[model samples]
Target chain A: MTEATFDACIQAILKGDKQGLRDIYDAYLDYIYRIVYGVVGSREDAEDITSEFFIKLWQQADRYKAGSGHKAYLATIARNMAIDHTRKYKKEVLESFTQESDDDVVIEPVSSDNTEAEVIEDIAIKEAIGKLNPKEQQIINMKILSEMTFQEISDILKCPMGTVTWRYREAIKKLRRYGYYEES
Target chain B: MKNLEKEYKDQIDREVPDLWSRIEAGVDAYEAEKKAAGTAPSSTPVTETPTNITPIRKKNVISIITRITAVAACVLILAATVKVTQRTKSESAAPAADAAMSEMPQNTNEPENIQHAEEASEATEAPDYISPITEAEADAEPSNSYKPIAGADSDKNASPSLSPSESAVIKDPVTFDDARDDLLPQLEALGFKLIKDFVFEDSVDKRSLSDDVISDDIDIRVASFTDSKTSDKYYVVYTVNDDGAADILIVRKADNTGDILYTNPSYKNK
Candidate 1:
């Protein structure tokens, strides 16, 4: 969202208006969801955390400083919340959820009646992303889907900007090698 | 690359379920919990009416209690005055009656009455006694007043026991190194030890009155030490005069006021 619009939404949230929170959630849900999904690597867990992320935003709306970059603020909070969730739950729980989703994906029928171009593209992209490691996937999601700058990603990751750019370059190279990029 | 990014964003958007309902429910629950705890800011006005009515009842009960206390106080004052008058009359009449009267209350009631009267008179006279000191304090308050608060960290730096004249300044002009060597022993003799030596060039910007302390053309060195005996911090400024002799200046760093104690007349330094 634009800075002015975000500030207005924050003012409304501070005044205990639910519509303000809804406006923020509507504007940034896809961006926040992608960042959370990137870190947790599970759709169910991402949805749950993304839901909690808005609740946190509603609760901490007063902490939003005016004229500070809102996208970076949201990205930092979302990334930290996702990391906290992963640390709170054991590795085996997340793995079991991923394994169950993978089993569902394998068993689902892709017949001519139900198969569409978008579904096929979605499945193809999902499988291509599945091949990339979690770090590379996180960088790709933050860099492309959330439209975050390398400096912001580095700040949230607490690493050097050069390392962030290098990792993003490596992830893009790996995606290209996987034939995920379409040639013009 | 743009097409691939667009595809990924669209897929994630399709996958992320709408959570506005859950969020609204959570917000409602949070507001409800805060309202139950009486901490909800928006609900405070609604709750204030009932709270405002109960204080009226409490005020009545408090006033009644205060009236009873005032009556008891008046009765006690009358009893003390009557006893004081009786003791005066009996003491003037006969010394034998004074011994009998002192033994009558087991000597407790007389002393307690006298103590209560003294305490009441002191309480009424306290403002009169403190007013002169308060005026003096107000007059001295304009300049950085040296009164250190009790139990404050600044108490470590403010030594009320040591007068400013007690701070030692080397009288004769000596070489910079020689003066510094002698200055440490002199201050140590006065119960001070070296804390740190600060570079003169770096500390020039730190002092507000740098131009008054030393001329820019002169070479100088600065060292700080604390008087362990009096808990005062002192800074020794060693400056080489045009005659090839160093003039020493001692400044008190007590409470960061940077008050100069003694300056040498040989140099244009304060």
Candidate 2:
């Protein structure tokens, strides 16, 4: 839904309109679910987190400001909730991470005649990313996959913006060494 | 800032979408459970007062009650004072009259005269004492008053003291339930569904008040629920006091009833 429409729905819900809540769920559930999935890295975990996110929305619906993008605000809430879940269930999350192999982490290559080349490129990049320290790997992933700005990455990782820039440079240097990118 | 850094940034951006999609799916699953449990179709009205009361006729009813109590107290006090004064006068006058008669030249047959004078004084003083009380009551009547007692004395030649709007608010509490019930069908016809039934309470903060005037009314609160599945919408119900104006607020869900996305107010009802 358009931001204007989403805002209207939020106002309705804040006013204690049940239909507004239902409408919001039906309209933007996929977009919100996707954001939660991105952070939690598991369908089951994402589903659970998404549900919690909605409940939080209902509880705090009145706090939403009209002009602010509702989707972005909700995404931030979902990300925070997912992080909280990860912290609470750290052991399970770590086990799940260890079980998933490099191949499991990589996306299935699209049907192109150059699929083998793309797969090789993905493998090389993934291995190079894996070789970095965990914090460096997170910085790279958040910048690249999450499309977060340097400032946003710094905020998310609880580091300075300069540190985020330095980390990305180091990760990119490692990727280049692994033949994942051309050296300039 | 370097050339190599620039090259890598381009590559990362090109490859990010696929990875992001996988990450997003994982988050969706995690949130679904919480959303299911929290979105239990509550029928409570949402309000700033925390009492789930849709702002309506509660204020009017409270004002009427206050007016009635104030008027009743004034009437009672005046009546009691008049009764006490009459009793004391009769008690003192009996002795004084007997003393005066004792001083008179042996008029032993004056008992009939004394009885007739007592009766005549009582008949004259009763109306005189009551007239002022009635006039004071009329003068003390509330501005824009709507008390039903005003109507009760109409045929008895009492003044028409209540304004139209005041009477409407006073009479509203009795008809409020029926009026609200009757509107349910109209609300349903307008596409509202009933959800969970719950009572709401409002709290008063003394520190939040700037004035010393305290309210003594207890607010009665209720909630109604409805969903627009086809439009993927939900509405919060509210009714205004003047003209019984009804409003429904719209909300949309994020995914599978997991999260609710509040569409901005500007886009609602369109």
Candidate 3:
């Protein structure tokens, strides 16, 4: 995941090197999977988007500017793929059932992470994350899993930094209130 | 809250499946597609979703269109086959019917389905216009020289319901021709020479024929005779000629079933 390695990967991709893509996939799989899983809340959907994300990386090697952050570029694509998947899935559901605008429906997700599902792997914290709204889970996954900054989160979410931080703080408070942690 | 965040980060992350095989295959396919598309002679910048051209969906659309085109081709072929079959039947049917007609003189198998032809021939052969030749007359005449002038253009709306005025619109050419031709020889057998054959428009008020008729256009031909020895007025006839179809046949429909709202004797028009 070093800048030099990332640049080499991009160069190899431009030359149609499958190994280069594999190297990138190996590094970012968990990070990207968490981003997709956090948004879509389904392991199956996460794998599809994650696999597709690496292929897009290989295909769009030319698009990545050398100096800009490589992980950020990847995170953006992952978030977009997840968002696009959600929109499409919602649209299909709407079409199959009845004609109603999907924008009106709030996205309340039970997060993919689970504390009770296992003792290790931050089970309590992960379970608490699940109780948070879908966007909150997405932001927390980006923050904790990918180390994306509040400003970077704001940029991707297309909102103010303050709003991103407020959601992050609010998400933490909601997790605590769910009784995994005592009231501060 | 800080403890929770610390604990969340401290815990080992969950591992996703080692998708090396699937992802590598996908990436290889993607690179192969890009290489192939790059070689294509076009300049639109490619999209990034790695599957901008959805393979299954594109196939489905083409499949539906192919099915539609196949159906259209089938319809066209079936229509052509039907048309050819009908033509074969018509061409073959006409000759066979003519043969059957030649077999019987007075006894045409006038099927009830052919209402117009039966009514036209039978109803119009009233005692006033014709009298059956006697046995002595028949003995002198050749048996076949007097066949009913084969069927008139029966499709002409020769309705039995036609007003006498409308009925007159159709000149009895077949009846007149058959009778004249048959009788001329019989009269000659007795002793008479045909003096002159003249064709003139029947001066009967042509307007009564129909609004579509012009008096000048109606040709009424007649043959006059005198006795060879006595030179007495023997016979004359209104002519019936089939050298030309009765009138201009106007086939306006694709069915090739031509139509005429009304017709009268005229120089046969196509």
- Candidate 2 chain B worst ten-residue window by lDDT: B210-219
Q: Kindly report which residue stretches of model 2 are placed more than 4 angstroms away from their true locations once superposed.
A: A15-19, A22-44, A83-133, A145-147, A173-184, B1-270
Error of 2 at B137 (Å): 66
How big is the positional error of residue B113 in model 3, measured in Å on the Cα after superposition?
Answer: 64
Sort the predicted structures by lDDT, highest score first: 1, 3, 2
Candidate 3 deviant stretches above 4 angstroms: A91-123, A131-170, A177-184, B1-12, B32-270
**DockQ score, prediction 1:** 0.21
State the lDDT of candidate 1 residue by residue for A1-184, as single tens digits. 8999999998888777778889999999988998888767688889899989998888888889988999889988998898778758745534433343222422234345332222333245667776776666777876776566788666655555665676676665555544456333
Please write out the lDDT profile of model 3 over residues A1-184, one tens digit for every residue. Answer: 8989999987777755566777888787877887776556667887888888876776677888996998888888888898688667845532322332344444345353433332333347667777887666767766765556788666555655665676676676566555455233
Q: What is the lDDT of residue A173 in candidate 2?
A: 56
lDDT of 3: 0.50
Put down candidate 3 lDDT per residue, B1-270, tens digits, no spaces.
236645554442454777677777876675566556643211112543445446545767888999999999999999999978864654343332222222221222332212232223243222211112222222343222111223533432232233444334433546445545544532322112332342223553333222233232333343334433343332232223243212221101111221221121222121
Per-residue error (Å), model 2, residue B89: 47
Stretch of 10 with least lDDT, candidate 2 chain A: A113-122
Write the candidate numbers in order of decreasing DockQ.
1, 3, 2
Candidate 3 similarity to native, TM-score: 0.37
Write model 2 residue lDDT over B183-212, tens digit each, in one string. Answer: 343333222333233112124232122111
Alpha carbon lDDT of residue B108, candidate 1?
Answer: 27
